[model samples]
Target: MRKIIFLGALIGLIAFSCARLDSFLFNPYKTDEYKLDAYDGKLQFRLGPEFDIPQDKIHLFSISSQGYKIWGIYIGDTTTISSDTVILYCHGNTGHIDYYWQRAKLLAHVGGKLRYGVLIFDYRGYGKSEGEPSEEAIYEDTKAMMQWLKDKGLTGDRLVIYGYSMGTAPATYWSSHDGPLTPRWLILEAPFASAELMVQDGAYFVLPKQYVTDLEINNAEWIKNAKAPLLLFHGTEDKLLALDPHGKTVFDNHPGPKQAVFVEGATHSDVPVILGIEAYISEIYNFIKSH
Candidate 1:
C-alpha cells in the first residue's frame, strides 16, 4: 500500500494521494524524476582522486528528505565551481546518473562561454540514492542538494534551475518556495499540467480525477509566484503529454518574466537538436545574462 501524504478524501471518491497513485498511472522509470550518491555512500566530496573512475564524475551525497541520501554527479571540469553560473538540473522520470551522463555533459556546456557547471542527481529509490520516492521527499532531496551548493559559496542569481519532463515539479516548487535561495532563472523543457492530467492519456482515464492519488505537481499554482525569469520549451509533436494544456498551460500561468520557445518539428527531448544547439544555447545564454 502506498503511503498517503496529503488528504484522506477528495470530492467524495476513493481518497488517494498522487504519491499513492504514482506507480499506478505513470511510468515508474521516468517518473522516478529524480539519483545521487558518491562513489561510495559517504557524505564527503573529494577532488579528482588517483583512483580509476568515469570521466567528469564529481559524486557527492547529500542528506535528502527524511535523511535519505541523494546520489548526484557534478559534470564539468574542476573550474566549474568558480564559474558564475551553475545549472541544477532536475531530470525526467526514469533511470539514474549513468543514463543522464551523456546529456549532463551536453548541458554542462550550455553556457560554456560563461562557464557553467551542471549538477544532476537521482531521487531516492532510483540508482544509488537511498530510501523510497514520493512527492515531498523529492523536493527535500533538491533542498538538500541546493543547500549543499549554498554551503559551498554558490548563491543568489548565479544559480539556474533546469527541469525536464517530470522534473518541472521540483524545479518550480523549489524556485517558488525557496525564498532567498531562489534561482536567477527557471527553465522547463516538456513540462506537464499536473499529476492528474499527466496520468489521463496513459491511465486511459480509468480513475476519476478526484480520486487519482494526489501526486499533484500543480505547477500552475506555483509559477505565478516565481521570482526569476522562466523559460518553457515543448515540442509541437509531443507524443506523450499534449502541448496545449500541459506546456502552453504552464507557460501561460507564469506571472514573471518568461519566454516560450516552440520548436517546429521537435518532439519531447529533442528540442535542443531541433532548434539547433547553437541557437538554443544562445537563447538561454541571453536570457540569463539579461536577467
Candidate 2:
C-alpha cells in the first residue's frame, strides 16, 4: 500500500511538470523572441525563385507593423482598372513564401483564366517578413496587408481571402469583425475549429494545446458571426488535422453561403492534389461566379 501511494504521487508530479512546461511553450510572450530569431533565418533561406516579369506586372513590397515587417508578392494587371477583383492568399504555416511559389504560379494561371489579380504574402516571421509569429501578430499583419492592398484601390467587394491551415485564424477573425473591409469571399483549407481545441486534440504532438497561451483566435466563435461567402476544403483521411469534427463544426456554425468539399483518401497535405488542381480551380471559380 505504501509503495502504491508513492508511485501515484510520482505520477502526479510528472504530469504536473509536463503541464507546466507545455504552458511555458504556449505562452506567446515567452516564445516570441526565440521564434522571431528563428523566423529571420527561415526567411533568408527561403527566398522564392527569381522570375523576370515586367516591373509593371509584379510588385514586391514590405509593410511595417508593430514589431514586424510583412513581405508581399503582388501579381496582377498593371492596367489598374477600377472594377478588377483580386484574391489575397494567406498561406499555411510553414517555411516561407518561396515554398508557395508553385501555388502562386497556379493562382496566377487560374487568375488569368478567371480574370482576377492574385496577391500572396509571407506572415511576419515566416518568410522574408520580420518578427515572430503569434496569433495576435498574424491578425495584425493580415490587416496591414489588406490595408496596403486597399490603399492600392482593392476593396472588400472585389476581394477574396484564402486561408490555408493555420492561416485560418486571422482570416476568420477579420471576416467576423464588424469592419469597413470585409472580404467578398472567404476560403478555408483544413481549418481547425479553434486554437484551444486544436491543441486539445494533440495535433502538434510535441506540445499539448493547454500549454500554449494567448489562444485569442477562436474561429468557432468568429465563424458564427462571419457574413461573407465561405468555402471549406478538407481531406477525409486528414490525420494531422482530424477533419471530421473540426471542419464540420466550422461548416455548421458558419452563417453565410457555404460549401464544403471532402477529398476522399486525401491526407492533410495532399487534398489539393487529390481534388485535382484544375477541378479545384474550377470549383472556386464557379463559387465566386455564383456568389
Candidate 3:
C-alpha cells in the first residue's frame, strides 16, 4: 500500500508541475461581452469611418469543438463565403475577438471593401467561448472552425490561414499536417519559433520545454513541412519575440516559396501600423495574386 501511495504522489507532483508551466504559456481571460470599439484601451491604431463594415456583412456565431462551443465573428455575408477567398485568422495569446477586431477589419478591406472574408474567433476559454485553453484544445478549436467553413462550401484553394504570435502554432500545425484542408497561402506575423525557444528565452537558459508545458508547438520544425506559398511579416524592433531567434528562425526553416517583409521600427503589435496601411495591404494583395 505504501509503495502504491508513493507512486501516486509522484504522478500528482509531475501533473502539478506541468499545470504551473501551462499557466505561463496561455493567457486567456473572461469577458462579459466583446465590445469591439469601446473595450480595451491597448489599440494603437483604429480604423476611420471609411473602414467601417456594413452591419449586413458582420456575423457572430459559434460552433462545437471537442464538445465545447467555440465562438467566432465572420466579417462577410455567409452567402459570399462559398465564392470569396476567406482568411481564417488565428489570433495571438491576447484577450479575444474584441482585441483583434481592428486587424480583422483591416483584412476585410485587404484588396477592396469586403473583398475577402475574415473570420476571427475566441479560443475555448477566452471571451464567451466554453472550456479552458489547452495546447490540444486550441488545435481542436481551429479544426472545428475549418469544418464549419467547409460545410459552408469553402474550398482549400480559397482559404488563407493567417497566424499571429501564439496563434502561429495551430496555423503551422494545420499547414504542415495532412488534414481535411490545406491553406492556399500561409501568412505568419511575428511568429515565435517554438515552445522550447519560448521557455529558453524566459529562463535565460536551455531547458526542456516539457518541464514547463507539454505543448508540441514547434513552428520552426512545422514550417519545414508546409508547402503553401508563405508570406512572413516581422518587425526589426520587436522586443516581445525578437527578430533573430523567433521570426527569422521560422522564416529561414520554411522550405517553399516564401516572401518576408521585415518592417523597420515596428514592435510586435505595431507591425501593421508601422508598415503603413497602404503598403501592408498592397503587399498582401500582390502576394495573393502572384501566388
Candidate 4:
C-alpha cells in the first residue's frame, strides 16, 4: 500500500509540473518585448506614405480605448447614403490592417459598387494602437470600436463582422455575448477550433481532441448561440491551421445561414486571393444583400 501511495504521489507531482509548464508557455497574460517590436513594425507599415489609401475615397478615424488609440479607415461613397451597411474587419495576427492595403482596396471597391461602408481597425499592440496585446484587451477594444460605430447610428443588420486568424477570437466572443448590438453577419477566415487546442497542437503535433480548459475560446460554442449568418473561408492546403477539419468543424457546429469556401491550392495566407478576390467580395456583397 505504501508503494502504491508513493507511485500515486509521483504521478500527481508529474502532472502538476506539466500543468505549470503549460501555463508558462501558454499564459494568456504573458506579453513579450517581441510583441512591442511587432507593434512598431505595424506602425512603420501603416504610417509610411505608401500605406495611405486614396484620401479622396476613404475617411480615416481614430477612437480611444484603454491605454490605446485605434486608427481605422472607412471606405465608401459617403455621399450615397446616410446609413449604409458597415463591415467591421478584424484582421489576423501577423501584421496590421495596413498590410492588407490591397485587400482593403478590393473590399472598398466592392462596398462602393455594392453600396456599403467598410471599416477596418488595428487591434491594440498593433499599428497605431498604443498598448500590449491580450485576449481580453482585444475583446474590449473591439467592443469599444463597435460601440463607437453604433453611437454613430449603425444597427445590427447594418453591421457585419469579419475576422481573420487570431481576430476570430475577439469577433466570436463579442458576437456571442455583446447584448443588443449583435452583428448581422460573421465571417471567419482560417479560424482555429479553440485556443487550448491551438496551444496543444503547437506543443504536440496533434491535439488529443478531448482535453478541456477554461482558456479555450470555443468558436463552436459561440457559433451555436450566434444569430448572424456565418461565412467561413479556408484553404485546402493550409498547413498552419489545418483547413479541412478545423474550418469544417466550425462550419458544422455553427447554427445559422452558413457557407464555406475551400480554396483549392492556396495556403492559409493566400486563400482570400486564390479563391478569386472578386468572387470572395461578391460572396460577401451577396450575403449582405440577401440578409
lDDT of each: 0.70, 0.71, 0.89, 0.69
Better of 1 and 3 by TM-score: 3
For lDDT, the strongest prediction is 3
Off by over 4 Å in 4: 1-54, 77-82, 111-114, 202-215
What is candidate 2's lDDT per residue for 1-291, written digit by digit as tens? Answer: 999999999998987863333222321221122222123443312223332233466666788877577788777773562467887888777655665555655565553443677777877666667776766677888888888777777779888888877788778888888554799899888888876777766653645455664465578889999878898888899887778667888888998789989889887766667888777777778888889
lDDT tens digits, residues 1-291, model 4? 999999999999988753333232221221222222123333312223332345576766678877577677677644542377777788777666656555555566554453567777777767666676666666877888787777777888778888887778777777788653699888888888776566676667565533433355678677777888888888888898887457887888888788888788878778757777668778877777776
TM-score of each: 0.77, 0.78, 0.92, 0.76
lDDT score, candidate 1, position 260: 90
TM-score winner between candidates 3 and 4: 3
lDDT for model 4 comes to 0.69
Candidate 1 local lDDT, 127-209, one digit each (tens): 66777777776677777778777766777578899888878889999878964368989999889878666666567665655
Q: List ranges where model 1 is wrong by over 4 Å.
A: 1-20, 24-64, 77-83, 199-208
* Clash list (residue pairs), candidate 4: none
User: Which stretches of model 2 miss by more than 4 angstroms?
Assistant: 1-56, 78-82, 111-114, 203-212
Error of 3 at 139 (Å): 0.9
TM-score of 1: 0.77
Candidate 2 weakest ten by summed lDDT: 28-37
Q: What TM-score, to 2 decimals, does candidate 2 have?
A: 0.78
Write out the backbone clash pairs for model 3.
none
Candidate that scores best on TM-score = 3
